[model samples]
Target: MSTTFPLLTATAVLPALGAVATAAVPAARREAAKWLALLVSLGTLVLAAVVLIRFDPGGARYQLTESHAWIADFGVRYELGADGIGVAMIALTALLVPFVIAAGWNDADADIEDSDAAKQRRWRPTQGFFALILMVEAMVLISFAATDVFLFYIFFEAMLIPMYFLIGGFGDRAHSGGEEDGAKQRSYAAVKFLLYNLAGGLVMLAAVIGLYVVTADQLGEGTFSLQQITEARAAGELTMGTNIERLLFLGFFLAFAIKAPLWPLHTWLPNAMGESTAPVAVLITAVVDKVGTFAMLRFCLGLFPEASAWATPVVITLALVSIIYGALLAVGQRDIKRLIAYASISHFGFIVLGVFAMTSQGQTGATLYMVFHGLSTAVLMLVAGFLISRRGSRLIADYGGVQKVAPVLAGTFLVGGLATLSLPGLAPFISEFLVLVGTFSRYPVAGIVATAGIVLAALYVLLLYQRTMTGPVEKPEIAGMPDLRARELAVVAPLIALLILLGVFPKPLTEIVNPAVEHTLSDVQKTDPEPEVEAAK
Candidate 1:
């Protein structure tokens, strides 16, 4: 790539530029914005791919770091860099965006003019879609690349704005008359998603400020960058005591947990899924939510290694709860989208399970799991959106025998759903296996219980497939449902290829991840040694 401008920075900024250009088009010409957004997303994907190709898997530190002063007096800098984990997430974000655009294609103009009243209803969703997507892209990029703690928190919180608008404003619906109906549901979902995130973020803000204070007081006014924090923590300048570190860790953990929507905090996701468009849901559920798992690794583990060790049992218990809980709830869902949302919650439990396991293989699996899950979720959401659009309903009963008509569509959904269940030779199977293997070495009981979640995953995914794709050819509406078109296949097929390819040939991908993961574990080991236990004398 170019020497002067880093590829990672370009990948982040290009989408914002495209969003602006798309918004400037006249109302009548706004359709151009959709294509522009698609192109920008495609470009960002290419850039991320280039980063993967050029990245040195054996490197000891962040590659292609670009740092400059942003707020000089406050010691904040416009810093960006990625290790293996960041690179993988960057690619996942890029991969999700194009499919998001494709999934929303029909919904982008859902209220278009067939009559004068309908014409008035066309309030230009393309612009809002473009803007929200670009905003998400930029925020995710920043979150991935940021080497500074303060900058990381900023990007982490900024993501909420675009996501709130995407769920609340763009795809929202109002009830015909009752309070529990249509648009009212969307409003409630949006508010719950926002309020939960904002409250968590505010708590994190306090922790971030406190981190800076401690770093300054002890380390002699060094920058609030993550790299600096690590250096100080290493040099014995920053004391990671049980009380203070646990508080700080919780501050970071609560925000990420809410974002990950782990267990109880995950209540907002099903509601949000019910109201949002498929593409927006794909981005929110697939890419943006990865931020939570990503941050758990980046901030919680990175900054408070001692606390992480101290809190492992509690986190692991919660993860187990989410695994069993999300799966049981998913099995009970009538709304297909909400079912997928709960599946994500279950998958996230596995991701956290890996991280708290605190082994190299487990963390690597968790990180890779994020990438694999991102792809599968995107595929499911896009294809599910198509299915819903044709049937004019989100209920699974509306989809009985759809396979008899839309064979290609049903086939695509089958592939995605199977991957979600971690069928052998698919991507998730490997990641989930690695996580269980790695966690088994450390937290044996947790690993054993979490393995049961895989069985639950199978039940939910297979039941979804049976309800929507198999069974009797009873419903006439299912017979009329169209099969996948070329354009639709174009959007989903790459994801399928990647999923299979990664599952079979994970060596190349794992090599890219090993170096960064090794560095992370090295830090954790350095900060927290096993405490000396009193003998039973």
Candidate 2:
């Protein structure tokens, strides 16, 4: 069952309009911006929930679509739709924004000692901060809902502007002592992130153009519609030759790998997340990063199945390397924010591995991992932000025996950490387990190597927890720190509850995701290789 309601367009537009509305308010009333942004985000969440309820999991195609000619001459249509995976991603984006706003409510007024120059450039967390966040939400929603390749690219690049400002503008200079040095470091991280992504985008643009040219040659006119391209490929009516197809695939894959921040290309993420505020970090690492893996499944494989299959060996190797390398680095980090960033790189490896595995279980697990990662990471970052706000530092060394003073805060942090490490009763555990089960069924060697990540995950999370939350109250400043406040609890409680709920009862999410995975695998026209067993074993 499909229907036309313009819900997707509404979800994409409301946040931008809200951003404008928040910006229009007077500076004296800047506090009102947070409330307004919250309302808008909540409304968007409701719309996304409606979409989820209305979505037919059994349907193998985009639903509740809004398609109309945008640039008729170029065959570019303003198309918006969501399949099960897209719906889940959209819902995750919507569900997280309101909490981000809430988590950052007092960020503007939070007192921190900094050099004069640092104070001058520091983000005030005023109306503009909230506005930029809302703008990002709008673009993100559009990017996930977009069915036209050009439309997706436009929204995809458009998301960077707000996120750039969110990192550079709103970030604290606590990592460095000198105002000049800290500001410079923040600027450098933001720029590195932008340059890396922009380079990838340019490469993808060339591929997009190549695809259009090939489509025109084959079908007599150019098209940037994903569905059309996919159908043409399936029907064997669009053949760009194996070489061109692989080239096009690489173009798209390169952009996604960078965004996915796969292995070596992931250098930008740690710095960016370290320099950015917690809420912004959550937005980037959790919500925005999912776009990379999602596009891998949607565009890379959907349009270039043969190339994807051919490249699986290389992709799986990178995924395994990411799993090990990211975990090792995470264990070595002193800064909590950067530690979480490395942890994310490790988790993203699992997501990518599942995507490239090309089995029904693998795709479903990857998609679910996207949602679980966002929620769990949000809890970790937000709770850590609470600790930073009280301690006026983000370094783990600065903290000791925080639990004695702030037991609730410590408990929340532990929950977040456990979820991050994929504790047996947490949401991430389910997704991670499925990813391994699926991968082992096909690529047993890679799957076995990747399991080491699970052990590494426990080490890093527990190490961080033990270093900061346990031991004697050595720091006088930390001894009197207050526990989690009402507002802080309000922000984190739902995330914790959902993690537990989904961990135990994941059937609702899995039912929605399974069909979508089946659909994606069907598009690729591949099945998992049968596992071999020894005769007497």
Candidate 3:
């Protein structure tokens, strides 16, 4: 998979350059800027396709690698590479950005200057909104492809800047709180998101520095290169004391867990998604937040195998809590957006459970879950956003019998809900099933408790659909509500198609995912457990 050309760099840089060009567009030419950003994202998607095509799953582990000296004195390098897992995530990110852009076409109406809230917001420049999105995309793409731990950490934390502005400045216009209260809430959510992630980043910084020192002592040079460090450890040239390994592992894991937004570290997500516009919310969950879990596979496990194993039991416990607790909370949620947000927490719990399950099926399922969750969450959240925009209330009580008027919207939302609950004949079902199967093979009690989450998921998703989409059109605002418009349809349709297509024939994704899972298991020096029962042979 080695290459002389820098495809990875070009793939990342295109949107970054696009972001700059987009920001420089005439202040009044918002449409032009939007078009520019969309085209840039599409171009990025083309490059991602090439990356995927060039990738040989059966070839070397890391493909399309580009390495160059960056900070030789400190042993840092401008290294970028993609394994099957990284490439799959990169493809997911690329595939989704255009849809996010298309869905948020009018999310930040810079011309709505008549209202005091708009003026109070200083007619927040439309150019900045789109620019920030592209900027975030560039950072995330780099994060996925980055092989140097320092390089990854740099872009990992940098993505938050644009995301913070996207959430705080261009929040959802359909707030039940009135404009002023909504603005306050947006600011609060944005700040809380920043503080939470930044706290985790700071701890990670300490761990990063500790890693450099450890490498310096062991290898005679301070290095943050994942490949170099791993090779050294594999060669018996470097080893960490048990306590040191655990501390370093905690630093990395805490940051990822927060990014994963696992329970206890998950409070910021509800507020952030509740206050932000839906597209940005999707970016948070579907794209930006993935860096955390991806890092767990790449850095936490790849670099700290012993520590990863040592902490698996506790991590699995937290994941189980996240699964049940998030589903239970989703069942009780009155706000439509918060319900989706809480549901994501539960989905992430399943994902983390797979990661720590330490079985080949478990890790592979976790990886697939990330991609499927991105597609399904986008469909549900964007459609929900459309529904809320029509009613101007995020409250579930404000909606009723939507299917009667906007059947298309309701139908798409139902599919999304079913996917979220991992219903059979959907993409998420396979991933979730693999996770449970993997976990059961190792820890039956954990797997049994996790099934409770599936039941809870059914309750929340069905109840949400029942209350909002399939009722008597009692609420006056819903009677005149229209179905998914052409633009919104364009966004949700393909994602739904992907869900069904992958559901029935997951070979394409599984083919890519399985090899990556094998590499990851090798990193941890683990294998799938043997089945307890034998076929009647």
Candidate 4:
């Protein structure tokens, strides 16, 4: 087989391939459609594992590199590769896709009826759902792999379409909330998400144009490629004064912060999460949300070092407020899922805090936190889905005494909850500790406040567990509810295993991430010398 079609590049395209195959399947064979979708997801997962095994953790640049000139006039290329961070995220996306598919298996009934013909029609839309999800998987993979800034932006914006449909059409409340109610909620969320992102995109577009202009003015040539830009900036050939860098910083920061859905700009998350299905939520939170954090590391900090240094204090403050605000809101929520969704806001704040701290340990901790958060959150949401499926409610007050009937489920809830709380020996603890340690070295006050988020996390996670799993088995309806099934266990066991494994052996992952991080930080150091930069010209 040609190396060009190596596992990494092919992984992104496979889902699009699956979408095509799924579209071709006759509407009459809905069962076959489901099976085919499952197979495609599994294939991608296996391919991702292969990519991970083949990955060189020691490399400081993207490994398994693939590039092809694709919009030559605009300096765009079909570039793909992974450093340790990208590979870990790719693995996380691949790992979560199968579980997302499995979650959809017994959950797609809202679209089908009792009749065989009705089921066939149900199969059609359900297949469409699977196909859309696969497309999403492909987009996320490409977004992560794209080495050209222009290419990255294309994949970055393309993700919104599939996700908007996923939340709007496949949602449990899509219809019951009334045509106007559900439609309005989804539409509002979709439009808000799109507009906020587009606004950021516009700013970044200006920045990118400015970058190309600067490069051509200084080096006698223009290129929109990431490597080209990095090299030019590193060589002191691309120059932006302090004021210009600050504007560009805000442009990139707006896009990431909106996506990060940081404090004050985080209005879109609750509604979106409330309207989306569990699997859709997993995809949105675990995979799509990381893009915001990833872009900050890749673009803003990579390109605007002086601006990044200037804005660190302000961004760290917002991050702290997000942590506090999210935790407070989580405590007041009646909807269990929404509460977990808000909890993510708080956790993301911690990640941002670490990243902006700009210490090697801080960025590495932020990266690990990203991966661990994805794993723990996927399992938590799956378990929540299982409960909602049995009880037919997401309201915390509606649940009581579940522990007596579903001991296994209660235990699963315990594991997921404790993991979320970052209890010792859990994966999050290692990262959270590193984040605090690293951040404290720079801004002790911000680090101290961010540390308070951990306490709130424990309270909210434990409170959720107590209300849902440990109450007396009084309700006749809930008392007869079934425990976790084989399929549910199949979907979640890997996450639990990984949480434990990473908690114990984080060094292997961290060792890989630190080298690339050092290289990135070196770029920042080079840009710190504004006088020398001006002198070079």
Candidate number achieving the greatest TM-score relative to the actual structure:
3
Model 2 agreement with the true structure over 355-471: per-residue lDDT tens digits: 988888788889999999999999999999889878878889999899988999999999999999999999999999989988998888989999999999999999999999999
Better of 2 and 3 by lDDT: 3
Tell me how far the alpha carbon of residue 15 in candidate 1 is from the true structure, in angstroms, after superposition: 0.5
Model 1 lDDT per residue over 1-537, tens place: 124566777888888787787766555555687888888888888888988777787764787788888887877887778888998898888878887786676565654565766555537666767767877887898799888878888888888988888887766332234434766787788899999999999999999888877777787774778877887788887886689899999998999999997987999999898788887888888888888899898888889988988888999999999999999999998889989999999999999998888888788899889989988888887888888877777888767877777888999999999899998888988899989987887777888999889999999999999988987778777777779888789889999999999988888778888777778888789322233566789
Per-candidate TM vs. native? 0.94, 0.96, 0.98, 0.93
Preferred candidate (lDDT higher): 1 or 2: 2
Error of 4 at 535 (Å): 40
Cα lDDT computed for each candidate against the true fold = 0.83, 0.89, 0.92, 0.81
Q: Model 4 compared with the native: what TM-score?
A: 0.93
Which regions of candidate 1 deviate over 4 angstroms? 1-3, 114-123, 172-180, 526-537
For model 4, the superposed segments whose C-alpha errors exceed 4 Å read: 1-5, 116-123, 174-184, 526-537
- Highest-lDDT candidate: 3
Give the distance in Å from residue 414's predicted Cα in candidate 3 to where it truly belongs.
0.6
Model 2 bad stretches (over 4 Å): 110-125, 531-537
- For residue 121, model 1's alpha carbon misses the true position, in angstroms, by 9.8
Candidates ranked by TM-score: 3, 2, 1, 4
